[model samples]
Target: MKVFADLEEFTQAAGTELGPTEWLEIDQQRVNQFADATDDHQWIHVDPQRAADGPFGGAIAHGLLTLSLLPRFMHDLYRVDNVAMAINYGFDKVRFITPVPVGAKLRARSVISKVSALDNAAQATLVTTIEVDGAQKPAAVIESIVRYAS
Candidate 1:
């Protein structure tokens, strides 16, 4: 993991890849829980038996589920010390490029994009791409914005 001493250090490192986060398994239980919480109990995501006859063959994860893993992935990738707090400003661009099948293993690769000042705090954007293990394509790609009180 790369540590940025200040905003200047982060800004100067544009296009540099920070870290590859640990892989997370996309299990049915978690998918069901997400489905239950979101009230999105679609067969493609929750019912494995029924989804086996659907488009993705077996049960697949919801696109939002993969997108929601950003914070967890980022936490494993890097950290900015001495910050009073950090807030998720929002995502700039987000795409679910491919489906994450049940039991799939995924990890994130975070690249430093831009770091600038947002009022009294520092705002940074990280372009994160989540790739499934042993797969040729990425599951999701997103540019996440975060504000940190320095």
Candidate 2:
């Protein structure tokens, strides 16, 4: 993880790709829990038996379920020092390019696109690319923005 004691330390290091987070497995139990919470109990996401005859030949996780893992992904990615708190501003862009199959392992690669001042706080945007292990393409790409206060 890259530790920045101040905003200046972070802004000076733009475009650098931080190391990836630890691999997180997408299991059926977790997917089902997400489905239960969101009322998105779609067959492709929760019905393993029926999904076995579906497009992926097995159940797959919902895109939002994978997207919701951003916090865990970022926690394992990087951190800043001397910041009182950081709030999620929002995502500028997001795309689920590939389906995350059950039991797949995934991680995120982040590039600090820009960091700018916002009154008494600072806003940082990161182009976070999430990829699945052994997969030829990325699973998702998101422009995540956050506001940090000292």
Candidate 3:
């Protein structure tokens, strides 16, 4: 993980690549829990037996489930010390590029794409990409925004 002394230190490092975070498995249980929580009970994501013959050849995780991992991945990527608060301002862009089949392992790498000043804070946009282990394509790409305050 990369540690910045403060938000100002973080702003000066634009285009820096933060990490390919520790691998995380996408299991059926996690997928099911996400489905139950979000009320997205699609057969392709919840019904393993039915999904085996579906387009992806097996159950796959929801795109939103993958998107939700942004925070988890970012925690493993970088940290800014001496900040009183940090907030997930929002995402500027997001795209699900690949189907994340059940039992797949995923990891993320992020680039500090842009940064802008804020009152007692800084807003940064990280272009984060999540890739399925051994896959040719990334599972998702997102421009995640965060606000760090002193």
TM-score, one value per model: 0.93, 0.95, 0.97
lDDT of 1 by residue, 1-150 (tens): 778776545556667786688789999999999998899998999889999999989999999999988889888888777667889999889999989999999999988788776665788888999999988889999999988886
Candidate 3 lDDT by residue in tens digits, 30-128:
999999999999999999999999999999999999999999999999999999989999988999999999999999999999888878899999999
Model 1 / residue 120 / CA error / Å: 3.5
Error of 2 at 29 (Å): 0.8
- Stretches > 4 Å off in candidate 2: none
- How far in Å is the alpha carbon of 73 misplaced in model 2? 0.9
- Provide the overall lDDT of each model, using Cα atoms, as 2-decimal numbers: 0.87, 0.88, 0.94
Error of 3 at 88 (Å): 1.0
Q: Give the number of colliding residue pairs in candidate 3.
A: 0
| Candidate 1 lDDT for residue 109 | 94
Model 1: lDDT of residue 21: 80
Off by over 4 Å in 1: 6-8
lDDT of 3: 0.94
* Per-residue lDDT value at 3 in model 3: 97
TM-score of structure candidate 1: 0.93
Q: Measured by C-alpha RMSD in angstroms, how accurate is candidate 2?
A: 1.1
The residue-level lDDT of candidate 3 at 70 comes to 90
**Tens digit per residue, CA lDDT, model 2, 1-105:** 767878657656668788688888999999999999999999999999999999998999999987898888888878877778989999999999999999999
